[model samples]
Target: MKTILILYYSRHGSVSQMAQYIARGVESVPASEACLRSVPEISEVCEAVADTVPDSGAPYVTLDDLKTCDALALGSPGRFGNMAAPLKYFLEKTSSLWLSGTLMGKPAGVFTSTSSLHGGQESTLLSMMLPLLHHGMIISGLPYTEADLISTQSGGTPYGPSHVSGSDSARPLTDEEKRLCTALGKRLATLAHKL
Candidate 1:
């Protein structure tokens, strides 16, 4: 079976929800499976450290996961139009994999969630793609062939899947957003088989 690692860092739970939807999409494909993993919160204190295991949600990701996965789906909550610090910190540790080209030629995709409708979701998704591109992974985005990509008014993008969680971050994903997320995951898994 092909393993598509769904790695994400979600603070307000929106992105995490998106990850689950994406995993559903991945698993819908024959011979494809999703591996959901998340990164721990980063602390500003020099000595502060997160626990080895997270209390809830997906387990913390490891470098070995990156090296072993057949494909990748990266997700994050937008922070000032960029990926959150915790996810960035984890990617920085991937230099060893980058040097060895462990992720080269792998099919990958990105996703994000934002509080506002225009809350930099695309930028955040694009930013997450940078490291994967450097690792030589082929990037995939939601194609217009997906009906939701054309009809989605809440959150969905050609760059990838996205969600607009609202000001209080309490809004659940709209039906369109959910479909788009699943579409991206399925697309990635399908591409992995072709590649």
Candidate 2:
């Protein structure tokens, strides 16, 4: 069976919910499975470290997971139009994979959650794609053909799936957002299977 890693960092739970929806879409393919993982928060202190396991939610991700997955679905909450620091910090440690090209030619996609409709959800998704591009992975995005992209008032972008969490980050993923997340996962899984 092929496995697609649904890796994400969500502070307000919206992004994490998106990840789960994407996983469901991935599993819809008969031969593909989803592996969910997350990164721990970072500290400003240079020498500080997070516990091996998080106090709640998904466990911390490891490089091994990246190397072994057949495909990738990367997600993060938006922080000033970019990916969150914890996820960025984790990606910074993937130089070994970059050098070895472990992710080259793999199918990958990105997602994000934002505090407002225009609060950098698309930018955050694009920013997350930069590292995957460096890894030589083939990036995928939701196409307009998904239908939801044409009518949704909530978070769903051609760049990837997204959620418009309210200013306080209390909003949940809308049905449109959930469908887009699934669409992206299914698209990635199908492409991975073909490749």
Candidate 3:
């Protein structure tokens, strides 16, 4: 079976839920599967180290996951219109993969969650795509054909799927957001199968 790596970092849990929805979409493809993983949180202290395994949620991702995946769906929380530090830190460690061209020609997509409707969700998705681009992966975005993209009032974008978690970070993913997430996963899986 083709494996699609769903890697993400979540703070208040919105991004994590989005990842799960995407994974469901990936697994919907008969010939494809999803490998869900996440990165450990970063500490404010420059020298602090996190546990090798996260206490809850997905295990910390490894370089092997990136090297072996048939496709990739990267997700993260929006931080000042960019990806969160934990996801960025993990990407920084992928220089070896980049040098070896391990992800070259692979299909990839990105997702994000924001605390507010205008809290930079699209920018965060775009920021996450930069590293994938540098790694030579083919980027995929939600096309207008998805229909939800044309009508979503909550959180869906041409860049990728997103959620508006509200200021308290308590808002759940809307039906439109969830459908878009699944669409992205299925889209990536289908593209990976074709490639």
Q: lDDT tens string, model 3, 1-195? A: 999999999888999999999999999999899999998888888846589978898988999999999999999999999999988998998999988999999999999999899999888999999999999999999999999999999999999999999999999999999999999999999999999
What is the RMSD of candidate 1? 0.8
Question: Could you tell me which residue pairs clash in candidate 1?
Answer: none
Work out the TM-score per prediction: 0.98, 0.98, 0.98
**lDDT against true structure, model 2:** 0.93
lDDT tens digits by residue: candidate 1, 113-163: 999989998999999999999999999998899999888889999999999
Model 1 segments beyond 4 Å from truth?
Answer: none
lDDT of residue 118 for candidate 2: 92
The better candidate by lDDT, 1 or 2, is 1
Q: What's the lDDT for residue 62 in model 1?
A: 97
The 10 consecutive residues of candidate 1 with the worst lDDT sum are 41-50
Off by over 4 Å in 3: none
lDDT per residue for candidate 2 within 22-68, as digits (tens), equals: 99999999999999999987889784668998898877889999999
